[model samples]
Target: MVWAIRGATTVSNNDADEILTETQNLLKEMAQKNGLAEDDIISIIFTVTKDLDAAFPAIAARNIGWTSTALMCMNEIDVPGSLKKCIRIMMHVNSDKDKKDIKHVYLNGAKVLRPDLT
Candidate 1:
C-alpha cells in the first residue's frame, strides 16, 4: 500500500534559525507519528506561505538525516485569508500497512489547515 502523510507547521519568525528548528521538528514529528521508514519514503513535498520566502524547509529534513529522501520545496498559492508563515509537507511512502494506520501531523499555528485533525 501507499500512504501520504500530510503535516503543517509555522515558523516562529522569518529568521533562519526559527525556520530550521520548526521545520525539523515538524518533519520529525510526522515521521515518528506515521512510523515512516527512510527506505519506505517515496518523496516529500513542502510549501511555505507567501509571507515566508526566506528559506527552504526541505533543507531542514536533510539536516536531520533525510539526505537520501526525495524532497522538494515550493510556495503555497496566494489565497486570501490563508494561514501565514505556515510550512506544509506532504510525504508519500510505500508501505504494506493499511492506509488508515498512518497519522498525519498538524501543529502550531498551522493547525488551522486541518482544525479537526490536530
Candidate 2:
C-alpha cells in the first residue's frame, strides 16, 4: 500500500537556521508518528509561503540522511489572507498502515491552518 502523509510548520523568522531547524523537527515528528524510515519514503514535496525564502526544506531531509528519497521544494500559492512563514509537506511513502490510521502533523503557527488535525 501507499500513503501520503501531510504536515506543516512555521518558523518564527526567515533566518536559514530557523527554517532548517523547524523543517527538520517537523519531518522527524512526522516520521516518528507514522513509524517511517527513510527507505519507506518514496518522495516528499515541500511548499513554503512567499515570505519564507531563507532555505529549502528539502535540505533538511538530506541533512537527516534522506539521501535516497526523492524530494522537491516549491512555493506555496500566494492567497489573500493565507498563512505566512509556513512550510507544508506532502510525503509519499510505501506503507501497510490503513489510511485512517495515518497521522498528519501541524506545528507552531501552522497549527491554525488545520485545527482539526493538530
Candidate 3:
C-alpha cells in the first residue's frame, strides 16, 4: 500500500545551511518515527513560504543522500496570518503501515500546524 505522510517546519532564515539543516532534521525524524527506508519514499514535495527563497528545500534531501527518490520544491502561498519562514513537505511512501501508525512530524514553531498530532 502507498501511504502519504505530511510534516511541517519553520526556519528563521533563507540561508542554505538553515534551510538544509531544519529540513534534513524534519525528514529524518519522520523517517525514523515511521521506519521508512529511502526505497520506501515514492515522492516528496516541499514548499516554503514566500518569505524564504534562498535555497531549494529539495537540496536538503540530496544532502541527506536520498538519491533516486523523487523531490520537488516550490513556494507556498503567502496568506495573511499564516506561518512565515516555514517549509512544509508531503511525502508519499510505499508502506504496509496503517494511517493510525504513521507519525506526522511538525517541528519548531510549525507544531501549531498539527497540534493534535504533536
Note the residue pairs that clash in candidate 3.
none
Better of 1 and 3 by lDDT: 3
Q: Write the per-residue lDDT of candidate 2 for residues 6-86, one digit (tens) a residue.
A: 999998899999999999999999999999999999999999999999899999999998999999999999999998899
lDDT on C-alpha atoms for all candidate structures: 0.87, 0.95, 0.93
Best-performing candidate as measured by TM-score: 2
Ranking by TM-score: 2, 3, 1
Q: Give the true-structure RMSD of model 1.
A: 1.0
What are the runs in model 2 whose C-alpha is more than 4 Å off?
none
- The true-versus-predicted C-alpha distance at residue 102 of model 2, in Å, is 0.3
Which has the better TM-score: candidate 1, or candidate 2? 2
Give the alpha carbon lDDT tens digit for every residue of 2-103 in model 3.
Answer: 988999999988788998899999999999999999999999999999988888989988988999999998889888999999999999999888888989
Ranking by lDDT: 2, 3, 1
Q: After the best TM-score superposition of candidate 2, give how far the Cα of residue 7 lies from its true spot, in angstroms.
A: 0.2
Better model by TM-score: candidate 1 vs candidate 3: 3
C-alpha lDDT of candidate 2 relative to the true structure:
0.95
lDDT of 1 by residue, 22-72 (tens): 999988898888777688898999999888877888899888887898999
